[model samples]
Target: MRPPYFIPADRTIDYQLRYFQAKQLHQAVVIDNNSRAVGLITLEDILEELVGAIQDEHDFA
Candidate 1:
């Protein structure tokens, strides 16, 4: 995978959504500063993560 497609750890969720949508990438690889393959971040992965986060917040509330 292209390194430029890798997202920074600090990027906002909205930014990620737009980036992926504009790039037309269904998935991306998560890399560290050392340029190592940390994990995979797909569209489904982000969506699930977002959903889980929202549910967690709701549960806490």
Candidate 2:
């Protein structure tokens, strides 16, 4: 599989959400100042981070 999309920590939630959907991306490696992965951000995590919700096909509207 290809690497997940990377975004800066300061990125807006809307941008991240759109990126996650358009790319069908499940996870990303959050990088730090030295251009190294410092943490991971999964779709599940993003959903939780944004709306405190969980994503599932049945929940799509």
Candidate 3:
């Protein structure tokens, strides 16, 4: 099992990306001020947040 990455809610998006890149992190558990997980963010979610939308040419059934 892989350990989840962690990020404080106050951290900037750039910091989160740096941590993700440096650690090769895939998933992150966002923590509150008390150090409790409040949300989860994944690589895919970050990409989507950054890029907005991506349309694929491949057909899906």
Candidate 4:
């Protein structure tokens, strides 16, 4: 697989998702204030998160 995609930790969730989808990155690195790696997020992880969020919204509705 390609090297982990890197995204700034401070980026908004919407921007991060758009950027990752645009680059077709399988995974991403959430870089921190000191430019240190804080976490790794995969495409599958993103999808799962989205699904969970949708379910939550649906429940609330």
Candidate 5:
């Protein structure tokens, strides 16, 4: 099983991307200041946030 990873809710998109790449993480649970899970995030989400949404051929225009 993969180890669990968490990211602060207030973190910047750039920082999050670097953290994910450094740790080789595809996704992680987002946490508030108190370490409560707020949501989930993925590398794809980070990339899309940086460069706008990514749509594949299967996606409708």
Candidate 6:
């Protein structure tokens, strides 16, 4: 497996989005101030946060 990309958790969503696009990364590991793996972030998550929730057929009630 490829090594995961790590990004600072303090970064803005816009910065992270650009970084992801530049590297063609779908997901990344979030690093906290202590350099610990604190969470995971995905391209979809960034888009959704920027544009609000996205709905698809799978979201049907």
Residues forming the 10-long window of minimal summed lDDT in candidate 6:
52-61
Q: Give the best candidate by lDDT.
A: 5
Candidates 3 and 4, the one with greater lDDT: 3
- Find the number of clashing residue pairs for candidate 5: 0
Sequence-dependent TM-score of model 5: 0.88
Angstrom error at residue 54, model 4: 12
What lDDT tens digits, residue by residue, belong to model 2 across residues 1-61?
6966676666677877888899888887777767787787777877787778875786866
After superposition, the stretches of candidate 1 with alpha carbons farther than 4 Å from their true spots are 1-4, 52-61
Per-residue accuracy of model 4 over 2-59 as CA lDDT, tens digit each: 7667888888767877988899787888899898999987766676766654344446
Could you tell me which 10 consecutive residues in candidate 2 have the lowest summed lDDT?
Answer: 3-12
lDDT string, candidate 3, 1-61, tens digits: 8877789989877788888899999888999999999999877667766887555575354
Candidate of highest TM-score: 5
By TM-score, highest first, what's the ranking? Answer: 5, 6, 3, 4, 2, 1
Error of 5 at 20 (Å): 0.4
Model 6 lDDT tens row, 1-61 = 8789999999999999999999999999999999999999989889999999888786875
Per-candidate TM equals: 0.60, 0.65, 0.75, 0.67, 0.88, 0.86
Q: Mind giving the per-residue lDDT tens digits that candidate 1 earns over 1-61?
A: 5544787666677777888999988887777777787876777667776776434443665
| Candidate 6 positional error at 1, Å | 2.9
Worst 10-residue lDDT window for candidate 3 reads 52-61
